[model samples]
Target: MSEAMKILFVEDEEALGMVVSDSLRSRGFEVDYHTDGESALQAALENRYDVLVLDVMLPKMDGFSMAREYRKSNRSTPIIFLTARSQTEDVVEGFELGGNDYLKKPFSMEELIVRVKSLAGCALNQENSELEECFVGKYKFSIQKQMLELNGKVKSLTHREAQVLHMLFEKRNQVLERKQVLDQLWGDDSFFNARSMDVFITRLRKYLRDDPSIQIVNIRGIGYKLML
Candidate 1:
């Protein structure tokens, strides 16, 4: 209900795809239906959709292969797989391939609608949180993708780099205590864990080196502060 969500639905079953696509359209969603994997992948690459509902079994390329290609380009779009394959290994493989959620076939229409709406809502909320561009010197920091882009070149950050940078950006120009940062990030202040936090801080500082205006100052016996 927040915004009209565009959904790309890739199901091979003609009758079921029609029913599901019609139901979604009736409920204020814009649905794009594709019956084959090749066309589904083409549609997905050609257009941007809020969520993707894919069936594993398909003609030509499979759902897993399609998801892999999307991820290689750093597309963080959430995917929900709907397949009759209910084996645990299949589920695990789906997740490992970056599938966010999975639903077995013979699922309820209501359930599918609810799940899609919920996931889309979550994605929208995340987008809203990062509405403003984070200008750390010449680079534009994208919190959602955890990437720093400068002059058309982008560098991806590791998970720790992303998390630490997020916290620092949230408290820009404020001193974040070492213990507090450690506890908040690593969930502990033990000697070994403290070392890990130091490594992350070092990596973040290196990544933000392009921006002379931004510096992570270390306060002895205290913590770090983002000097902007």
Candidate 2:
């Protein structure tokens, strides 16, 4: 059997820390649990781990600071942050500081597992690989070629457009969080970037407008959801 994925998990809440660490261990993960960012950062520096699961609120140092320090020496390890606050600035700062993924507090174990496995390139249902092409509601989207074809007509998609559409298609029929999309696509969710994404969304709507069966609904205070 392959070695279990190593995780550096830092959470000050003893109860939450225990439950999450135990759950991850039961799921075949090797987790190094810590209660503070200072100790966690030291552990991270001394040892190598495949992934980092950090709680944003911690004593001595916050998760963002820990990750920022870690990145100065290492840039390849995937980091999954846990945050209780819903502020976009905190989330964006985490991304800007080099977080691979972020999970809001109260997240389920199953969702956490999926994100970890996806980043580790292990098995998330099947292979956790990038998608090349997808078909939805009479539209054929080729991400590699950045082309969308429908009803004998085709429209070229920009790189950003293709990336956004790919994400929407991947999470089709589900609410794709705007923060998540912005964090990955534009690296941060500033006002300008958010508005820019709106422009891209509009363009995508125009491209896929011919198909009445498909709809990209704007989910207020959340994000966008693609329904087919």
Candidate 3:
């Protein structure tokens, strides 16, 4: 048999942790279980796991803290957060912390197993990946070529446009704050640069108006959202 995928699971609840560990191991995963966030963070730093299954409520350190530390050291490892917290803010916070997926409380072992397997599979697929070119509505973004094509026509993007579009496409549908966008694209958030960004946004909107499903929504004082 091929080698099992390595997984690190952090859960403070003993019973739930045992159940999850058993379920994962039964399906050919090499599982390491931890009940505390500090220990889990240490293990994650010392060892490389294909995926991390973390619980939001953990002793010593919480899953969010562990995730933040893990991101500091590792960005490629896919993290699936297993938590009972189902509030909108909690879910948004999980995503903001770079969580690949979230599983709510009182989940089935079967569903959990499926999620773990699917996310792990995606992680593995991304390991030996080529540059992925994706579409934002009608605009085709070719990361490899650094070009954007709409319909049959292609518009060569300026350097700043390409960079901003890259960030927007990466977080498609997610609101990107104006300051964040400005900083990410230009490394500055001055008034002039902000106004320049708005101009680019308007240009991009016109270019993509061919597609009715794609829109760029302004969030007032906040950033913009590329709705796909």
Candidate 4:
């Protein structure tokens, strides 16, 4: 078997933390679990972990604060913030504080697993990609690495997300037909697949929104256009 991915998990809720950490261990992840932000922050810096999963609220320091402090030294490791609050500002703050992804409370194990795997895969293989990074407005995009960097903050993109962004970038300032993307990524342009592709487009637009000059435009019935 391949080496198990390591994780630094910080969640104060006893029962929930045990369950989550156990689940991750069962899935072949080596999780170093902690309950407070102080120890978690120290653990994060002293050791290397493939991913960091933190609870928003904790003793001593909150997750956001820990992440902000952690990012000062390490900006590449992907962080998934677990929060009970789903406010827009909270979510935005998490991302701004160097979080790669956020999971609201009541999330299913499957959802967390998918996110952890996707982010871990993106971070682990980054050093192995030789493809030159592409620039989109103010963002540096690495399709092979499945990541986007803006002003030093790195966002890990899902495989499908990276694929869609690459297609849009390759055909910038031109309409990229929805059918084309669907056929390539989803193997069909059916209504269900088309809608799924549209969701990705919306996320790409958000990721690029920091640069107002970069816009992913909807071309009505045709598809979409990347304006930069």
Q: Which candidate leads in TM-score?
A: 4
**Looking at model 2, which ten-residue stretch has the lowest summed lDDT?**
120-129
Judging by lDDT, tell me the better candidate of 2 and 4: 4
Clashes of each: 0, 0, 1, 0
Residue 25 CA displacement from its true place in model 3, Å: 0.9
C-alpha displacement of 7 in model 4, angstroms? Answer: 1.1
Residue pairs in steric clash, candidate 4? none
Can you give the TM-score per candidate against the true fold?
0.58, 0.57, 0.58, 0.65
1-228 per-residue lDDT for model 3 (tens digits) = 277899999999898889889988888889999999999999999998878989999889999989988877565566778877767677667655656566778878776766666545532233454646887776787654446787578765433455567667767899988898766443468764465566667766776788899888998999989898
Q: Tell me the deviation in Å of residue 18 in model 2.
A: 0.3
Give the candidate number with the greatest lDDT: 4
Tens digit of lDDT per residue, candidate 2, span 159-221?
456667878888999999999988765556877457656776777788899999999999998
Question: lDDT of all the models against the reference?
Answer: 0.75, 0.80, 0.74, 0.81
Model 1: lowest-lDDT 10 consecutive positions: 118-127
Tell me which of candidates 3 and 4 scores higher on lDDT: 4
lDDT of 1 at 205: 80
Q: What is the overall TM-score of model 1 with all chains considered together?
A: 0.58
lDDT of 4 at 174: 95
- Alpha-carbon RMSD to native, per candidate: 8.8, 10.2, 12.6, 6.5
**Model 2: lDDT of residue 49:** 90
